[model samples]
Target: MFEKLSYLQLQQYWWFLVGTLAALFVFMTFVQGGQTLLRELGRSETQRDLLVNALGRKWELGFTSLVMFGGALFAAFPLFYSVSFGGAYFVWMAILFCFIIQAVAYEYRKKPDNFLGQRTYEIFLFINGSLGIFLVGAALATLFSGGHFVVNEMHLSRWTNPLYGLEALANPFNIAFGLMLFFLSRLLASLFFINEIDDEAIYARARKSLLRCTLMFLAAFAYVAYAIATMKGYGYDPATGAVFAKEGKYLQNLLAMPAVAGMLLAGVLGLLAGVAMTLWGGSRRGIWPAGIGVVLVVLALFLTLGYNDTAFYPSLSDPQSSLTIQNSSGSRYTLVAMSYVSLMVPFVLGYIAFVWRAMSAKRLTVEEVENDPHHY
Candidate 1:
């Protein structure tokens, strides 16, 4: 059935798959967000343990989805993998380190007589929660904002800035997006806590955090939206396969394609609505609506970056090095093969859903953490 479609169809399919996985990963980062706020949310040792255990129950899902997201992007679009991964090594390394520490911190934080004290491990978790999500979001922002790398004639990439991946900080717009992710993660964390943690103190604090983070999220998001919509964008000449700068390209893309525009608007509204409902209604189940809203918004953002012949990853050092979905994707045969494997994605998602349901079937309380034999 898939063989009948053209190669371009396969590439688009893979892009969509990658986008979907990315959306899922973003939603899962709520675990990281919640971890970052452990100190603020928990006043007592028992309460802290409760928060850690609640977050611990699902941190692996975020990590696994992140790894899978990278792998899928590598298989589907080798050039982006090579260019971004190669050029942005510093930022990538930092994110990797953060995640590694997260896994270790969770495993040994509660272990008896661990070399590092529990406080130290908890700090590590906070680092992962804040810096990990922020840096990753910034790195992704480079997809639309371009980066400091030049691709040689042979397609070898060279970093133009001495700061390496950290150069992304120089772009205010990128930082804006990064801040948006950080705050959004925190917001989601609050919603999750409201649903998962039953302690009144923690629940009230989570609500407050959600409200504050939502404000920050909106501020950063508005900045990014304004910048992206008005800024000059990298456009590819599909006929020549050459990339060049075009003014208001993103806005044009939104205007030219009604479906994409509709998705963008819907995603934004969904995200806002979710946050509002959680904040105003004192809803315990805000996580569901907010989580789904994040997925939609992120998916729409990714589609805007990749579709419409835009350079998803533009090279600031050399214009010719810019990469579009058409040029950076793997060979048609490889894409087709991967497309077949993608069929199992539903099963994987189903398994994750089942695990999530079983885990969250009962709300987590301090008493449960103290009494449960399987406490993390």
Candidate 2:
């Protein structure tokens, strides 16, 4: 069945798969968000250990999803992978460093005679939770806000700015998106803790944190969404396949793709409902709805960026260098081969879900961690 589609169809199919993985990666960032709250929610060493172990169990899942997201991009859209990862070296390097520290921290945090000490490792997790997530959001924002790079006839790319994409910090819109993700992650983390941990104190603190993070997330999300709606976005000419600037381009895309718009709406409402149920109704299951909501919202945004002849990655240095799926995709044979491989994704996800369920079958407790010989 997969053999029958046109090249463009395959490109779009892979783009959709990439977008889905990206959305799942963002959702998995609840692990990062939970990292930031370890000290705040866990007042005692035992409590802190509980939080750490709970998060450590799932941290590798987030890391795995991240690796998958990058691998998919590299395989399906090598040009974009090269242009952004190569040209924006500093930003990507910083992100990589943060994750590296995170891996080290998780591995050695509870190890005997560790050189760095537990506090230092905890600080590293904080850096990953805050700085790492923020950098990711800002980097993604450049997809819409455009990046400082030029692509040559050979499809080689060069960074125009000296900061090597660190300049994205200068744009408030990018920062806004970063802040939004940071708080959203925190909110999701709070909900997850409420569901997964059996401690009453942690639940109380998570509830309070959820309220605060929700407010902060709403503020940043509103600003970013409004800006995108009002801002001039990159457009593509279907006949000529050229990139150009169009006012209210994103807003128009939402209108043009009503189904995408509906997804966004449903996602926002789902998020709000999840928060409300947790804050008022005292529902521990808020994470389920809220997590799915985040995925949907992020997926809609990605679809808007890539579908409808939109330039998913725009080049500020050269509009003509903007990348659409058609321009940035791998050859048809590669995509077809990858599509066959993509069939394994569902089974992989199902296995992950099974493992997650088995691991989380019982709520985590201080006694359990104390009894277990090995703990993060």
Please give the clash total of every predicted structure, in order: 0, 0
Which one is best on TM-score? Answer: 2
Candidate 2 per-residue lDDT over residues 61-157, each given as its tens digit: 9999999999999999999999999999999999999999999998899899998899999999999999999999999999989998899889888
- Candidate lDDT scores, in order, read 0.87, 0.94
**Where is the poorest 10-residue window by lDDT in model 1?**
266-275
Candidate 2 TM-score to native: 0.99
Question: Cα miss at 338, model 1 (Å)?
Answer: 0.4
Top candidate when judged by lDDT against the true structure: 2
User: Residue 137 of model 2: what lDDT?
Assistant: 95
lDDT of 1 at 210: 87
C-alpha TM-score for every candidate:
0.97, 0.99
Deviating ranges (above 4 Å) for candidate 2: none
| Cα RMSD for predicted model 2 | 0.7
